[model samples]
Target chain A: MPNLRVHNLTVSLDGFAAGPRQRLEHPLGEGFEGLHEWMFAAMRDRADGKTGIDVEYVERSEENIGATIMGRNMFGPQRGPWQDESWKGWWGDNPPYHNDVFVHTHHLRPSLAMEGGTTFHFTDEPIETVLGRAYEAAAGKDVRIGGGPATIQQYLRAGLIDELHLAIVPELLGRGERLFDNLGDGIDGYRVAELVGSPAVTHARLVRR
Target chain B: MPNLRVHNLTVSLDGFAAGPRQRLEHPLGEGFEGLHEWMFAAMRDRADGKTGIDVEYVERSEENIGATIMGRNMFGPQRGPWQDESWKGWWGDNPPYHNDVFVHTHHLRPSLAMEGGTTFHFTDEPIETVLGRAYEAAAGKDVRIGGGPATIQQYLRAGLIDELHLAIVPELLGRGERLFDNLGDGIDGYRVAELVGSPAVTHARLVRR
Candidate 1:
């Protein structure tokens, strides 16, 4: 069976997946620019990046992902009702994801076809329904859960995630959207399968037990 | 000045220092037994443990400490007025801390000197005042902050802690006392000095900037 994997989900030492008060100006919220420094550094040194574990994990997040599911917050900085449909997302015409992308939101929007193969379908349906659509769109390939914390938490709480790869950045956001809150019994079904560290961050992979 | 350092403070992937509903039977709190597995494993293989990073960190926590300061919770499982002072602490007779130990509490009690050089002094003084006493007792050696999450949070909020070494365990304690909660801007003063991982856990050293 194809896996429902969450990868390269960076969180602070305090467990904040994203800094608080995410806005149009600061998409990841304030004091979180440094959170993805490891990934940026790895991408910068692309030639020698493969030699480093940090880069390897960053690259691994994109592998074998046929479809992606993300929250509307991740889709754009827009909140509540959409101001306009003009916002084409943070990524330009050709987003990194070249497959069908499902955006979880309360406000419905028509399907958007972007440059390349990426298409955005907004839905307010239950997580299971969206996941089913994502899997169908994936066509036997693994489904990637692109997160903004809330979206990932939804999947995690539902125990739908097959694997979770977290890059724990050694920084304290103090106040932010925490990745591992209110998990209840949903977390009991998983165990840490792999743990490794690079100079920049510690990578922990949790698999469903 | 004697530096205030925190060592071997193990937290779950969700950043919980201790699980919820701590009591005598569940010292580290419920579902938190696995949090300290790395430390226990490292200690079990004492002869050859020095080669591993986990063991090295475990040993490092014990070195260069003159006095220890902990909250009431770390000292005993008793709550509110001590209940006759029959409890000397979890560690009987010759306790692990063989030095002047200060226990921060609301209810005052007479100082109790135990086996080995360990002496427990209960004080209702402020954090700064207690820290001053701890520093004086240290006699120029570093003072270790023995935590129960709340204790560490107090020290952290005041920026009194000089160094914090956290063992990031790869597990989830759904509900518990979070170490990094309500820190406000207190977390900004610290930066990750070193990060290393073993098979069991990842150790992160944060030093005041």
Candidate 2:
């Protein structure tokens, strides 16, 4: 099986995985850009010409991600009657998920081919189908649990995810979509394999028992 | 204001909000209990409890919270089909919200009465209307943008949430729902007012500018 893992995801200290007003302009909310400062600080980001440790880490975290799964919103802000699916995603020419992506939606559409290797596969086939497809696409590499909360919860309920990652930012929106509200029991058996600390991000790895 | 912050939120190094298999019984998911030991640690849990360093601050966060909002899932785990409003919530006799709770659902039903002075109002009303009612109920107090990720996303898209309290558990369901998959910018222009460490939870406060 492709080792399921979320490389680096940043969250607000207040429990918000993302910021308020998820718009094309304000993708991460008002003050969330700083949450991934740790990623920039990593040596990997620096190697990519990212100044400061923070930029370096951010660059590095995106590496080796074979495949991804995301909700429609993560792709863009098009809502309520998607206005005819013209909205590709928030990403301009090239989306971050350059390889392949499985998007969950009610509308049944065919796979969308983007400029880069990213191909948006709209699956009304249900969560398990998406997961199975994602796992297979990963080809025994690393599969990122790209989120929007609902998608993550589905996997959580099914117990398919293998590893988790969180980059804690020092801020709060006080009230917004919380990461865990109706969440069922999380993965029952797993151990923290590693814990790397920094001013911006605290990276860790979880291993299944 | 009664502060309803996430004092016990735990996150895995991988960035999963909570583990998979979300349910009434395993609210946090399996094995996830261990990942959040930091929050359950003596020091932090006490802080969110009736008394501690931020004792006075406790509940004060919710002071502005005149009314609360929640999704049907947060209201109950009745899945598959609505069938009937036969099932209640997992909270048992009393739920956490002692005030008005606006539950978002398509099913039309009368508001429910619960212990601890909590009332459940079911509505298909738009978030603004619900939030207006909650704000009115809050009467200058902060309104809590409650969840089921969908509910929170609605509020976030509206930019209604002022604060957030999240706990990141140290486990991964590799294939569960995610909180921030589609959040355009996520959180930006925020500050981490506090970072409380513990074994069970790590509570943090996020304030938006």
Candidate 3:
């Protein structure tokens, strides 16, 4: 079976995965752009044909990702009930994920078929059930847990992730959605399989035993 | 001039310098031992005559320091008022610090000279005033900012810290006295000059620009 993985999830030095008060105007929340500035620089290097540890890690994120699972907050900034059906994802035209994407939401909506072979399926079902559907959709390929911290926390709490690539950014967000909160005994069994230090971020690969 | 510096302070993956509910039995607080496991291991290696990055960092912390400044919390767990005059410190007769140590406290206490060259001087003065004394006491050597998170936060807020050597441990302390809280703009204008990754921890040197 393909491994369930979380790749290239960058967090602040204070462990904030994303800043607080996430809205339409500020997609990743205020002062959060600094968190991903390193990733952007890595992307630039890759575009210029420079391949190193960071570029290799970035390239590995897309290796076998056939399907993805994300929280509703990552899909959009809308809270409570979904008022308008016209609202799509934050990504314009073509999203980065080119495969089937399962979004966890209380309010159900029909499957959204977007351009570039990406489809959005909203669900209120249990995480296990959603995982089963996503695994079936993936069909022998790996499933990616794309997150905004809360969704990743649920998966981590459930002990469903096989491996995680966490990039520890040097900046301190101070206030934001911390990635390691409310996780009881969920993070006890992981070990850092590999570690790499770069100018932008400190990257560690956590493997579950 | 002697530089004001913080060295070899271990923190969790979440940027917590020390864990919650610090007391006599649990000096570093509950579950905080994991954060310093690397330091202990490094000490062990040093005892075994092994020299590496961890040992180098530990040795560097003691290289240039003369006097030290710490918060009341680091001095002891006694809060509000000091009833017992016998409470010298968590460290026994011969404390690790073999120099003048100025402790910031609201309550007044007489200076205690330990078995070693260590001497504890209690003060109710502002951080600047205490630093002035520490610098004077140092004569020429660098003054170290020994911390319990709150003390470091204050010095950071005042922009008195010239450099910081932070060790990012592998474990997560979900809740604790966060080192990066309530400083407003204190953490800005600093850059990570060097990074070292080992089995136990990832150490980063932050220099103010």
Candidate 4:
């Protein structure tokens, strides 16, 4: 069976996946500027990027992923009904994801075909239904859950996620949308499979038990 | 000036310092049984204990501490006025803390001197005042902030702690008393000075910057 995986989800030491008040200017919200520095520093193409554990994990995120699912918040800064349809998304022209991407949203939109093989499907369907569609689109490949914290929390609470990889950044966001809160018994099924650290971040891989 | 430091404060990957519904049988609270296994495995006296990063941190928690301060919750499970003074503490006879220990409480009780150098002084004094007394008790040695999470949060909010060391255990308690919640701007003054990981746990040291 193909695994439903979430990889390289960066969170602060305080457990915040992203800082408060995410906007166009500050896509990841405030106080989260340096949160993804470790991943960015380990980019495969970058000349100055460090090659080690961080890079290896970054590479794994793209492996065997045929389809991606994300919350509407992660797609753009706009909320509620779309003010303008002109907003193609944060990524310009050809996005990195060259596969089918499902966007979880209350407001429905027509299927959007982008420059690359990427096609954005907007759906207001329940988590299970959306996941089923994503799995079908994956066609035997693994499904990847792209997150804005809330999206991942939904999957986590439902116990639909098979593997969760977290990069714990050593910074305190103090106040923000916490990734681990309101989990209740949703986290009971998971256990830590691996824990390693670089100078910049600690990587914890949790697998469903 | 003697620095106020916190060490070996273990917290779950979800950021809970202790699990919920703390009681006599459950000292660290429910769902937290194996949270401290990493430190326990690195005990200096244990024949089978492993020595390395985990052990080094455990040893650091005991270094240069002339006095220790903790919240009432950390001292005992009993709440409100002490129904019975018979409960010296969770530790029997000679406690590990061989120094003057201050317990922050709203319901003050007479000081109970235990075996070894451990002496529990219960006081309803303000955090700053208690810290002042603890500093004086230390003479010139550094003071240690032994926490139950709430106590540590208070000192962190006041910016009184000079150094903070956290052992991030790889477990999901789901629900518990979080160490980082309600910190607000209190966490702004600190920065991650060191971060390392063992197979069992990840250690993060935050210093006031």
lDDT of 4 by residue, A55-149 (tens): 88898998999999999988999989998788877898898889999999998889899998999999999999999999999999999998989
Taking the tens digit of each residue's C-alpha lDDT, what string does model 3 give over A91-144?
987888999999999989999999898999999999999999999899989999
Candidates' DockQ values?
Answer: 0.73, 0.12, 0.36, 0.79
lDDT on C-alpha atoms for all candidate structures: 0.88, 0.62, 0.86, 0.89
lDDT of 1 by residue, B26-102 (tens): 99899998778788888877766356887788788888899999999998888898678778989999999999999
The pairs that clash in candidate 4 are none
TM-score for the first chain of model 1?
Answer: 0.97
lDDT of 1 by residue, A48-94 (tens): 53668887887888889999999999999988898889998899999
Q: Model 3: clashing residue pairs? A: none
Residue-level lDDT for B28 in candidate 4: 84
Q: What is the DockQ of the complex in model 2?
A: 0.12
Q: How many pairs collide in each candidate, listed in order?
A: 0, 128, 0, 0
Model 1 chain B, poorest ten-residue lDDT window?
B45-54
Quality of candidate 3 docking, DockQ: 0.36
Q: Per model, how much of the real contact set is kept?
A: 0.75, 0.23, 0.25, 0.82
Worst 10 residues of 2 chain B by lDDT: B1-10
Q: Sort all candidates by lDDT, best to worst.
A: 4, 1, 3, 2
lDDT of 4 by residue, B1-209 (tens): 89999998999888889988999888889988889888878894345654688888888888899999998888899988888788888889999998999999888888988889899999888999999999999999999999889999999999999999999987878888998876768889988888888877999999987
Q: For candidate 3 chain B, which ten residues in a row score worst on lDDT? A: B187-196
Answer with 2 or 3, whichever has the higher TM-score: 3
Scanning candidate 4 chain A in windows of ten residues, the lowest lDDT window is A44-53
Q: How do all models score by TM-score?
A: 0.96, 0.51, 0.87, 0.97
Q: What's the alpha carbon RMSD for model 3?
A: 3.0
